[model samples]
Target: MNGQVNARAGASGKAGEKVLIADDEPNIVVSLEFMMKREGFHVLVARDGLGALEAIRREHPRLVLLDATMPGMTGFDVCEAVRSDVDTRDTRIVMLTAKGRETDKARGVGAGADAYVTKPFSTRDLVQTVKEMMARDAAE
Candidate 1:
């Protein structure tokens, strides 16, 4: 219908959401950052739990994709820490890990994570989960 169609009309769509990707694996970080950016989310990377915490403080992202295992602080530890902090307590957290065991998922939820996605996952799944969390947050 036009050379350059700009049909989008929403404030949320214009600002774009910010998502922090915390993972010890460099490849995972790079891949997730690329995919999130392509999806129009501002992406921040943290290589460890400490780094994750720092990034959270600095970025104040709308959502966090946290890893279950890391050098200093595990995902559970990170989630717990974030939940305890008054400033970041409201931030949405999603555990991303290779640990697919039921116990691990339970642990993540117990630590204040909103969702859990196992490794070797499709980018579509990850993006969908993040969007769902954002939507749920908006409703709350």
Candidate 2:
């Protein structure tokens, strides 16, 4: 199904907790969606920052894998908006970006990302990080 499966309607994994994949790159989105689904997460996809924010509000995904650069709005902007909103503020955000500069990382965290992952990241590590973050959320 091109891996754009919107499992939001009836989630099928891990207590139906949702994980949104916010990336403009089709390949990245496809792979990440597939991996997240394999890891037992209900998946949602957004091609831009605006759509991501909308999904974050509507679906209330437990975690979001966000891209720093996106059309309509930047990931930093989306992160900041989510943080500012009381309803979506607690959503865990992991910035997945190609911009690995120290300043970029700082900006992402500053914008309220729970974690920042640079591009070319190992799939195993990314999955582990997502699991850890989701587990921590569950604990709290």
Candidate 3:
């Protein structure tokens, strides 16, 4: 497949699932977009925090790969906003950032993020984790 989208046939595959990747780095966004699209997920991109929040509201993606540091709102703010909104509270969030400190991880979790992945992470691990996450209850 030449970087084009592909939706798998019915039932088990997570084809067409929506995943929003919010990050400011162009390289990161481009790579993440390509990897996620290859996995059959409908991809959405937001370069900053506020745009991320808007995309979350408008797109209602099943999962979000959120960056803690961006131009405006920050991933923590976006996660907090999603967690507070009853309509969007169930949306899954994975805090992806360079900040790998224990406190940073704690804050991400405190803001209701479902998972945390540090920068330079394994794409294979990320994809597999995302699949496992999608299989779990969103509310949990």
Candidate 4:
């Protein structure tokens, strides 16, 4: 929570933020974990949606970067559940997925995601998205 990463597009993370990255893919999780940590945020990772929920419950991360598809519960389901929960309903959520269909974006939004980013995304985009969401959360 005390480092700085210069995201490729000149974006930077808000220091001391807590971010959770949930992905079934080990490499994606590791990569995001490293990137967020380097950007001065405390990072928590979960390999699946259930784990994601548990981590959120335990850590109450300020933000979550959730993968769309995963075992046990899809990210959509996680989003819906989180939105329905009083304690975490206001927590910032950004859905990350390879599915770029308009319907997929609609589904994520309908599930209460605050933001969305497609896979094969630019690191700069991800960092910028996270930073923006964090800023919005602070304003609220």
Candidate 5:
């Protein structure tokens, strides 16, 4: 899916800020969508890096939860692309991945990810992180 809006939230007529969840895993996408929607965000889903990038440009979500491993492009590559693009340069990106090595983290940061989160992550902590990041973005 390129930028499929969550149907439930779409019909609710009061979806809040946009947050894009870019992951290939169905379970992860569903869970994250639930969590973000509960937090009052208008959730958008993308199944791969390219779709995520397209959605970011097309939809201009407030933040993106990006996955490192996908079919066409890696999250690192997508992050770099977003950072490099003048129009979407300021879009906040949080890299969520199973690659927990120090070098992998460093690479994620080096690629311009605002934050890097490893898998097997705490949902509460992730929500808190997302809130903090969005708050910071708003304050700026």
Candidate 6:
């Protein structure tokens, strides 16, 4: 399985931790998937908003890296839905999108995102943010 993803040998995915990558962009998904796996996370991928919401319901991921826009449900809509649901209210959300305006950030936060990362963001920083957010939540 050349180029296949595998958790670093003997280093299983972090216990009780799963991350859902919800994005419509293929490149973004590919990179985020690899990065999250390397960070000891069991990764789940969703290509659109509906799939994202479905994955959230079924997988109950600890965190969701969500795109701001997609077909079917939009990230904002999904965020609101998750925030409204008691069972998923505590799930951390990081909005990932090209919309970097103050209003956009505000909208993301208003919808209940814990963090909003605009597109063209440094992947290194994104990874660190994810680690920090997830680790902090786990500790709490």
List, in order, the clash count of every candidate structure.
0, 0, 0, 0, 0, 0
Clashing pairs for model 5 are none
lDDT of 2 by residue, 8-102 (tens): 43234755478999999999988898888887788889888888888888888899999999988899999999999999999999999999999
Candidate 2 positional error at 106, Å: 0.6
Q: Candidate 2: misplaced stretches above 4 Å?
A: 1-5, 8-16
Clashing pairs in 1: none
What order do candidates take by lDDT, descending? 2, 5, 6, 3, 4, 1
Each candidate: RMSD: 8.9, 3.3, 5.6, 6.5, 2.3, 4.7
Worst 10 residues of 4 by lDDT: 1-10
**Candidate 2 lowest-lDDT run of ten:** 1-10
Which consecutive 10 residues in model 6 have the weakest lDDT in total? 1-10
lDDT tens digits by residue: candidate 5, 15-34: 33688999999999989988
Colliding residue pairs in candidate 2 = none
TM-score, predicted candidate 4 vs. hidden true structure: 0.86
Best by lDDT: 2
Q: Write the per-residue lDDT of candidate 3 for residues 1-140, one digit (tens) a residue.
A: 11122222223325337888888888997888778877777787888888888878876788999999988688999999999998889898999999999999999999999999999898889988887898775536
Q: Whole-model lDDT, candidate 5? A: 0.86
The TM-score of predicted model 5 comes to 0.91
Q: Which sections of candidate 4 miss by over 4 Å?
A: 1-16
Worst ten in a row by lDDT for model 3: 1-10
Who is ahead in lDDT, 4 or 5? 5
Question: What ranges in model 1 sit over 4 Å off?
Answer: 1-16
Candidate 1 lDDT over 41-78, as tens digits, reads 76767778888887787667889999999877788998
